[model samples]
Target: MSDIGLFEAIYSTRSMRRLKPDPIPREVLDQIITAGVHAPSGSNFQNWGFVIVEAADDKRFIRDQYLKYYREMERLGSIPRMADIPPDRRRLFEAAIHLAEHMDEVPVIMLACTGTDFPTYADANNPRSITATLHASIYPAVQNILLAARALGVGATLTTLHYFFEEELKQRLHIPTDKEIAGLIPMGYPHGRFGPTTRGPASDVTHWGRWGEVGQEV
Candidate 1:
């Protein structure tokens, strides 16, 4: 929207955990949410709901909830040690730790949720398996939010660590029990710079007509 082309937005959108506390303008926030709403939904059910937290008290409440488990994980040695991860990704984990510590200072916390349980084809008795419909319905919108924020020069990252306390979040936010929390996005101006993402080359991961057939000629 800010003259950031579509592919430019896509390529530059990074998971920004180290974010400044500067408040996002209301107009920019609205545009990000609008971008999310415009995403495709299965059957056009449009069952998603979003809650944006900017109030100090609400941010504290959610941040405390997140830290509860985060601290527990730390005490239990569940968090990956810096020495364990490869050097290339060690910085990301470090930034995640920083975010956990300062989550209360985030200017905005966006919670993306589904307003209704997704219809499933699996038998009710053995419905422990996840269905594609559930993800297919909500994840596109989450991606749109990240891209839109990037285009607006806002930093955004999708996280589900808060999902561990989803029910508590619903009660605190007054979201009904029927709704499902898809993602929790932290938004603000980035303390770090945006850059192209690092990843395995597409050729290494792509398959042609068959599985386990990487780099097949077109």
Candidate 2:
């Protein structure tokens, strides 16, 4: 395990999309998944399922699907125009595009999934039937995986573009029908450096005892 402090890990973890093609060691991958499973889940059900993809064909398929959907979104005007994106964030946006184009070359792809007995909100007319809280069970584990990867010097980014063609992905990957993939994280050694993320002050968003009750900065 890394000797880095907890807060240090939390603060410096960024969505690293540009990664080297070098394969990560199996032991390191095992430790990263172990960190994910250590995270708490609703009712302690611990129902998350992870799939680590290393096959060249599988990565190529995923990359093709990602580009297909990305192009469709662009055609539909769902994605913001280049000029609309803020100057500081344009680099990140370009990095994401780079990832999409070269996703097949990434060394590892991890799918963080959850089991579902009930129909998802997308499939059902009544959103309440499948409580939004269902996601609460899986995202913490995803965050843990990201933090662990950062601490171990692996670059990873959580992406959901696959959801656009999720059924095809499930069939291609042989994921169970009962499982829903929440996040697809491509992982490997970084082509760049890990550094602190840029964000607005937490005090600007934090409310005290009640809504509109702003508190002083910590």
Q: Which model scores highest in lDDT?
A: 2
Residue 113 local lDDT, model 2: 92
Candidate 2 clashing pairs, residues 3+ apart or interchain: none
Give the candidate number with the greatest TM-score.
Answer: 2
Task: Give me the displacement of residue 59 in model 2, in angstroms.
Answer: 0.5
**99-174 in candidate 1: lDDT tens per residue?**
8778889999999997455555435654433345666778999999999899888998888888779988889888
TM-score versus the correct structure, for each prediction: 0.90, 0.92
- What value of lDDT does candidate 2 attain over all alpha carbons? 0.87
lDDT tens string, model 2, 26-133?
A: 999999999999998767778789999999999999999998888788677787656778897799878888898999999999999987644344566766555554
Root-mean-square deviation per candidate: 2.3, 2.9
